[model samples]
Target chain A: GAGVSQSPSNKVTEKGKDVELRCDPISGHTALYWYRQSLGQGLEFLIYFQGNSAPDKSGLPSDRFSAERTGGSVSTLTIQRTQQEDSAVYLCASSLWAGSYNEQFFGPGTRLTVL
Target chain B: AQSVTQPDIHITVSEGASLELRCNYSYGATPYLFWYVQSPGQGLQLLLKYFSGDTLVQGIKGFEAEFKRSQSSFNLRKPSVHWSDAAEYFCAVALGDSNYQLIWGAGTKLIIKP
Candidate 1:
């Protein structure tokens, strides 16, 4: 019954600092995804987790962007040495399975500002 | 490359007026198309989708979309729009054979006037 949830609805930090954004997907959702929404821009896919299969990191911008899904549930997206360009809303979504048809339920994003 | 385009960056419509949001996508093969709506300060919500079958498909919230292969378009339409319909709309395409990878458009901001 619970929807996807993200922590720290807002975060502000200095450049070069590292930040971790957490996402808790809905129960029984085997597929989780992380996306970034920049100002005046569209949502960019980051990483995807589906069951025991290897995660898809192709959309990750760089090495600084990394994510891990522990116990096939919660996921954390870490931005190391963050830059001003990384200032945006980090969004998380989950679906019943890893497919194109199932709808993804999103959580209220975490708005991050890099100073 | 797979991509989606929402030609209109912004659309303005009076309340109770007809609404249509254009969406075009480019993919190597037949793609799965979807339309999502997002209200300010909220997450994205699915409006409708077109996989195959009939050319036209209906969805929740009195919305519907028509998929045209020749034009590579899946435009969302509503006979009448409500004030609360003001929000951002995104057109997305899922790669049919790319393990469900989705390519999203920049999004269109809808402005509803009373």
Candidate 2:
């Protein structure tokens, strides 16, 4: 009965450093998503995974932002050579299935700070 | 281009006062709309959603929303708001044929007064 869970509630890294945020989706949730919430801004879509494969990576801001899912359960969002602009709360969500109707359950976000 | 707009950047209401948050979307097709609330230091929580039905939809925490195709609007309403309702409200639209792409609004911050 666990909801989505994300690790390392907070991460502070220097500019140009790399950080990996992890997410554990609820059991049987085939659809996983990653999002970024910048200060004073709305949530920015990052990537989505159905099972262990990602079909839509367009939301990724750049090559530096990448995400992957494995075993259809866990996901990792990696930000390489982070910049100040990348300092934000990284959130993950999962749903029973992928589509417009399904409600996504969100996890407590990982607050990443790039100094 | 698809976009969701929340015209009010902030709204303040006393506890027990009526509340209405406006949302408008620009899309030719009938869209799936959602209202989410994010309390400070917490994750986003779904308030309600409108896929297609009787237009009026009820959701958790004593909230409801009406989808008006005539105006391309889906406004959230609560007859009486509690002090704990003070938070950020976001309007979003699910677009694309199948990819779960959601277009989000800038969000409206709600303040509660005693």
Candidate 3:
């Protein structure tokens, strides 16, 4: 009954620095996703992982953004050389599996501020 | 490309008044529609989803949504709103294919007035 959880409720870093955001999905969940929410904007898809399959990186804005899900449970989203434009709330979500019908449970999110 | 639109940037309704939030989506095929709400500094909570079968779907907290294929819309509605209902409402559409990625709207901010 535990929902998804994320770490570092808030993060402040300088431009060009790298930061790693963590996500702990619900037990038995096989799909994890990362998204970014900018002020006055919609949630922007980042990446997604389904079990052990190759992660879907199509939504990743650039090569500097990457993510890894370990043991099909926890996921980490890393943004290398962060830019001011990358400042936003990083949200993580997970579902029973990757499908159009599955409803995703979201975490509180990590607000990353690039100064 | 799949996309979602929430035309209203913000809406205000008195407590106990009926509410409706419009959502329109663009996709090649039938889409999986969803409505989510987010309070300030909180995560998104699923209010309802429309996948198949009945066009009308009910969700938690007395919320419901009706899917209208003719209008390409899935609008969320509630008979009466509470003050606690004030928050940001988002409309999203999931891909019908393998990716399962969600295309989200800019979101509509709901303001509950006494």
lDDT by residue for model 3 over A75-102, one digit each (tens)? Answer: 8899999999999999999999888777
lDDT score, candidate 3, position B22: 97
The native-contact fractions of the candidates, in order shown, are 0.61, 0.55, 0.82
- What is the clash tally of candidate 2? 0
Q: Give the 10-residue window scoring lowest on summed lDDT in candidate 3 chain B.
A: B93-102
C-alpha RMSD by candidate, in order: 1.3, 1.2, 1.3
Q: Clashing residue pairs, candidate 1? A: none
Instruction: Tally clashing residue pairs in candidate 3.
Output: 0
Ranking by DockQ: 3, 1, 2
What's the ranking of the predictions by lDDT, best on top?
A: 2, 3, 1
In model 1, what lDDT does residue B48 have?
88
- List ranges where model 1 is wrong by over 4 Å: none
Candidate 2's residue-wise lDDT over B1-114, tens digit each? 888999999999999999999999999998889999999877789999988879999999999999999999999999999999999999999974474978889899999999
Ranking of all candidate structures by their TM-score, best first:
2, 1, 3
Model 2, A1-115: lDDT tens digits are 4788898999999999999999999899999999888887778898899899999899999999888888898899999999999999999999988887789889989999999
Clashing pairs in 2: none
Residue pairs of candidate 3 with colliding backbone atoms: none
